[model samples]
Target: MTSFLEKWSARKSDKPKAGMRSAVDAFRVRVAEQKAYLAEFESDGAGFNKWRSTWFQRAPGGFGVTIGRDSIDAGQGLSYVVVETTAQVAEFLDDLAQHADNDVSFQKALEQNRLRRAALLNSAKAKVKAPAAKAATRKPATVKATETSQVSGEASVEKPKRGRKPKA
Candidate 1:
């Protein structure tokens, strides 16, 4: 007797149902549109540049969540999303969207991520500036006794006494 899997496969149509096919097509189109929208920012232009810089000023990695095509892989599933952000932030957002039970939790996670990123950036900036600060505050080296010498009326040098001198 044929296995249940084999019977099911035999009964299934090779082609998707008409409604399903249309839905898939629509999804594909939407994904394409989303990708196009994102690509617009990648180019150099005044409007896009301004938006990229300012859009997520309050968020980490310059990202905010919306319901849209997958930012990493546009042709796949849909969920809460982030765009124009670093890969790490995108992954964090994706995980947050998946596991968060409600809006409150999601907002909390987003805020935490933003604060964490700001701290990291501030730390990095501090590290970069620390060496410069140290250099600026450094004092000039003092002249050593050996470096001084008398060479006429213009300059004088005090030579250290050689050998042991009798105590007088």
Candidate 2:
């Protein structure tokens, strides 16, 4: 038998099926359109450059937020963070702390943040109802076993058989 690597290598030279090629091309087009839309959105004053703050500032205290490559100080009550060098990260954390101290919204957001341990525990546990218990609670299926016996010309009861009946 050909190894997986060998098979894969052999298949690599062959062109994808027409349907698959069209699907991939369609996906690429969609991705490009999305990228363009995002670019235009960002370029506008209401976009990422402005922290999308205008959209959020519909209320007196409302604010929009956007994360930067270097920092997590998005204007909203939340931010996405990226860790780089240790010193830079330390400095960023210090700045974030200072910002949080001064910003009531950020402080509130931080207050609402779930602890890592609690989040992990919550994620690890699934809350699915037991199917077996539900099945046990259901009424047992009633069997219709009565059939006319051709030989005796009388009705007889037998457990219903599953699947196709054998032809005599």
Candidate 3:
């Protein structure tokens, strides 16, 4: 007969609980469904933006995926899954379709997702580092004062007029 402690230890060695496994499986299924929808949209030559908007939500200037809590950090206390951008989804699909083995496909998807995220972060950083447009410089106009009429052969003092002359 097996002891209770031994049985508990055996269960603990399993790493992922049944609930966690189910959550991950559900996430995979959702990804597949999204991929199928995207394929249909592509075959019909429809605009991706419209389909994307319908499927995903915008998050911090990019798109996001909503997965179960177990799928993110191995059944952590986080309320929601980490957001995945549109590019990350595309890369994952590309990897999933290209690879034959499940493990290989998952590895490829992770690598591609990381690369896409790095590229996006770098682009954002570059935009932040870029200098702002310089404003155009204008030279001040020069005004010459001329004596219109001489008063008793003495130079008449004239004040420089500002702004446009009034219409007659």
Candidate 4:
């Protein structure tokens, strides 16, 4: 069976599929627009000074925001994505842009992002010798029977319990 790290590495090695880049870029543009909208009112004193457009708290006690045309409390049609506050917009956009409605695609996108930084370091030694070294260093799996006999150097036999014998 594959080890946990092996499985994770395999998943991380997958490149983001077509359109992934565009989707991420589009999401960024939308976020920028929302920020600009809030910025437009930043200098206004017409009862806008107390507004917390990017805060995540509920209204009255706090100011929540609706996305585009969405209601503050509910998600609307495809054009709008409602959120408790504007601060949550990026997270919602991440899921939306990655098409994370399904868990698998979401995981793939997530893995792709997780390893993005590692992809850039391209050191010469790692590129030339790492694979060969890794192959040479890997040890063969040990047999379960051999493992069981390691302490006593005996054949594979179940050892009796070591504590005081139970009453007959």
Query: What is the TM-score of each predicted model, taking all chains together?
Result: 0.29, 0.26, 0.26, 0.25
| lDDT per residue (tens digit) for residues 1-168 in model 3 | 889998787667545565443323444665677676656555664454555423444567565544321222212332233345555756644443343135554444444554676688999987776643221233223311223234422542455446797899
Clashing residue pairs, backbone N/CA/C < 3 A, model 1 = 149-156, 149-157, 150-156, 150-157
Q: Which candidate leads the pack in TM-score?
A: 1
- CA lDDT of 8 in candidate 4? 89
lDDT of 1 by residue, 61-157 (tens): 4566443322222213434444556443345434433444244543454445446766889999999999999977776444333344223323423
Regions more than 4 Å wrong, model 3? 1-101, 132-158, 162-168
Taking the tens digit of each residue's C-alpha lDDT, what string does model 4 give over 1-168? 989998787668666786555434543455566555455444463545434443222356334444332222112233443465444654554554345334454434444553553354556546777889886777645655567568565432466546887799
**The candidate that achieves the highest lDDT relative to the unseen native structure:** 4
Query: Residue 159 of candidate 4: its Cα lDDT?
Result: 63
Worst 10 residues of 4 by lDDT: 68-77
Q: What C-alpha lDDT values do all the predictions have?
A: 0.47, 0.42, 0.48, 0.48
TM-score for model 3? 0.26
User: Which rank order by TM-score, best down to worst?
Assistant: 1, 2, 3, 4
User: What ordering of candidates by lDDT runs from best to worst?
Assistant: 4, 3, 1, 2
| Prediction-by-prediction clash tally | 4, 0, 0, 0
Task: State how far residue 26 of model 3 sits from its true place (Å).
Answer: 12
**Clashing residue pairs, candidate 4?**
none
User: CA shift at 107, candidate 3, in angstroms?
Assistant: 1.7
Off by over 4 Å in 1: 1-102, 140-168
